[model samples]
Target: MTLETGAPENGPIMLDHDFFRDPHPVYREIKKNGNKPTEVILKTGMAYIPPGLKAWLVTSYEDIESVLRDPRFAKSIADAMPLFAANAPARQEGGGPGRSSLLYDNMANNDPPKHTRLRKPLNGIFTSRAVAPKRADIERAAAETLDAVAAAHRGRDGFDLVQDFAFPFSIAVICDTLGVPVQDRAAFNSWVQTITGAAGPEELARDAGRMAAYLRDLLRAKRTGTEDDVLSLLARSLDEDEAVAQAYALLAAGYETTANLIVTGFLTLEADPQQKRRLWSDPALVPGAVEEMLRHQSPFNLSLYRYVTETTVLNGVELPAGAIVFLAFAAANRDDRRFARPDEFAIEEPRREHLAFGGGIHNCIGKHLARLEAEVAFGMLIQRCPELSVLAPPAADAWKVSPTFRGLRNLRVGPVPGISETGRAHD
Candidate 1:
């Protein structure tokens, strides 16, 4: 497979707004190139990565798995510092070429030893057994959020599922676990939005700093207090900066991704009536359905920046050290090699393993909790509001404009034809 670089004859595929809205077509096109690592440019004005950053994109399931599992493709951001230092635009004020907030000092960006050490403090907190007891609370939260939506939109045709149900419910679960006060959620979300949104480095740095400070204060409170939440555990187990970083990491990583899973999963099911019927027909299928939805419309479109630790040839393409690489989890989940009829959202596909939560060591630590949350949230929704249906296709503005994450900004929903608001079918 040939690697296209620097304005190839056909030009590098632009990850523009359209690509953000519907990337599968491009994913298919990329796969047509023999599933090799294709060079893609992160265009100007995107979130996460710096503008004009050229990263090798791996989409095939096997190739993505290789990058994710291979030690050669490292997560240590320091390995790519010189690359960023040369390519990134000069930052104003508190921001610089490679400057980022301390919140990023967590394990996700580190290589082993440091990564292993930083990951240990909060390792067991999100396991299925750990999160099982919280199911009742999660269900109640989901129920209450839906109830509020119904009340606010009384006699109306619709309410935004993303804003009314998914976002608040998901964030609340993570925040409550971290012992963040209910009143502080709004400001906390604002800071997180700015940090994760398509803002310049200066804005990202500022908001990230704010979030880091907030986490530090919360860690301090948890240290002296009797709360038995995740933050409290972190405070006790790690030093101040590391504890604060981990707390921010949990909040940042947990909330929006889970929220996206819910919205995107629902949308995917709605678009496929057969799967929707299957899900409602078999309540026992909820867990498997969650996996299918995760595979079908992965919350995270791409993996975090994995720097090439050293020169290595992957899929016949030679990747030099310090090159930025991204494993396209969303694309890999739908690769036909690993999954039969991969595009179809089949809960009974038999192959339950997908790269949605990633693979290898740095796989999501909160995988169990995320699954539990989605299961409880979707289970409650299916049981309580089976009549709910999207009123219209999401507008262009509805898709969040982020290079790293894929989710709706809003999704309007209400009872569908032949189904009453009480969830009973009409005669």
Candidate 2:
């Protein structure tokens, strides 16, 4: 799926299934036709102006870094009124209220003062001082998940790494940390699906309304209850509306992205045997491995939409006010100028920054938690489930379509061979 552009003009390009499934080939083609900064418009009328969505797409690492850190490029989509108005019906109907509020005005969604205010309290929760105590508990949870998988499979046939391992593992850890009631797990899981899955506009609106009603009810109960949970913490800290908003934010932030990382990390490790072996041999490398995995397979292909606050020139391309931009973090991670052997997945590569969790003030607040979760979860899997292998082909080969995330819908795995009923493997 190569897209050939002539002379790098700014115009909309039809986004076919191939482009959505695998955008790299098209990105390379666009690069070939255009200069350093190019504007590749999507058929949906959304522009892919780089660095900031309002400007031209910054393909080079230096330019992307500069744009990401630059305050001139506004992160607020509300700034682009005309664009938002044009897309409002679609946007509103597609995951309004409970589902979209998390990304709409939470710390990650806002810029400057608003961002700072929202991020302050949440940031404290993820710092080393706060998170260090949870490490042992996290490790124990990971081990317990592996034990459950082993018991279920009994070293026979295969198991789904995504559903049976990563999904449940992440959910359980987050639930335990947040103190969500065990009885609500089923509803929470269903709500997450409605929020993240590709539902029709009407369906999305319906789901959002349903989720809001549910959360409101849950909040009311928590307000009168004796239990201490994340909801309770937020309730005590913020007003009712604000607390409910934070509840939505936590759900969106806590689940999908981590699930994508866990699934992609496993697939990447399975695909590259040498890297996997290195990870297995050196437990200390787990953190680096997780970072590299985050870089190599960025869960969010596109950053949140940002509108042009004013006319701006990025990398020699002029962008007008109200222009929509999508910072392609996935593309930036693979930029040759920033990363040596950018295509390769090497944990041993000297540490360098990547925009996997984004950059600037809008960088992920839960980064530490995500990293801790991945390190513990992946390390446990490799150590305990030594025979882990891909249940399905790579995502590119499978070509599953998702709007905001790229992940295998299903991942299967087999246990290490030669293990006895007592779980001892014959060498």
Candidate 3:
């Protein structure tokens, strides 16, 4: 159903269910229709202008950037309760505190002064100065995981990259950084899987409560004991309730996105051998490669929903106060106006601004860490596993299922001849 538009219509559009499932086609369609700023209102009442929110999908890069950085647009999901209620399912029992983390909840979710206060402590912890010491540990863990994968293959033909390499590598690094016990890693992995799965709102709520309780117990233990981990640091720095929020935020922010990056990076490299070869030859290129990967395969396609605190005009489209906006970072990253050859993946593309980590006060706090991890992980993988190739037949069907994160559920890899079992450089 199309919205009644008093404004002039400039293009043809289709409202199809597939649009939600795979929006690239729809985006292509929108782009093919020309550059005129027209609107396609969805049956769900979300408008797609071009590259913005699904509901109000703004197509223009400038418009999306404007809305993203604008103070008038509310960053908190709570602010858009009515809009979410209309589109998303109702909340389930035991959903616990809705806003959980300083990054995801009160601070990142809130606007202006409150956000600033909430983020200050976290900003201190995640800055380059603070996180620098952890780099060696991160690299070591990634190397060890790759070593294990190499060992497991043991001159074998193939192994699942996601399971054997990427998943373990990312999980181990995050668990180590957070100081979560190695013994508890399995349980935490299970919890994260349940929490992130395609469950109903009620299921998610229940999972959130369980996870929160688990974190609370961990925080209590850290406070009472003599340990020096992130949890302990947080316990010392924050109040009990705030500690819970921090723990929850770390779990939510750290795992899913990193896992996606690992899987997507591998897959993208496998698809483009030349690019992979270039990266393998020059390890220093990993940093730039990570940025290109982020631009090419944005893990968080949908923007965290924001509410309009005051009336705003996004790309000349007047949005009333209380309007819910989903800043489509995935779409904006591919905006032809801002990006040359927006559809193609070019690692050397001039370092133009991309919203992969988002923008404004609510940008990802773990951005540096995420980039570092991906760069190290992928850089090592290509260099160490020279014979790595897709085990599955080359077909689009080989891709995995996940709406929020785009990555392989199972990416099989074949080892190169002469590579050692421990992923060490072989003669």
Could you give candidate 3's per-residue lDDT for residues 1-427 as a string of tens digits? 2323213355324334344445577667656654323444433211111121224455557777777677787765445555555533443354323433222344545676756765666777677677778778887887777677656667778788777777787888878878898888777776666555444445445566667778888999899889887888877777777677677667666877887887776677778888877877777777787888888778774565566677666544566666556556777778888888887877666344787888777788888788878877876776677667787743454443233354556776786333344446531
Local distance difference test values of all predictions, in order: 0.78, 0.65, 0.65
Worst 10 residues of 2 by lDDT: 45-54
Give Cα distance to truth, residue 14, candidate 2, Å.
4.1
Best by lDDT: 1
- TM-score order, best first, reads 1, 2, 3
Instruction: Count clashing residue pairs per candidate.
Output: 0, 5, 13
For candidate 1, report its TM-score. 0.91
Candidate 2 C-alpha error for residue 85, in Å:
3.4
Show model 2 residue runs off by greater than 4 Å: 1-10, 14-16, 33-37, 41-58, 77-82, 87-103, 224-228, 394-400, 416-427
| Model 1: lDDT of residue 379 | 88
Candidate 2 C-alpha lDDT tens digits along 92-162: 33333434343344555568776666566576776767877888888877766666676677746887777
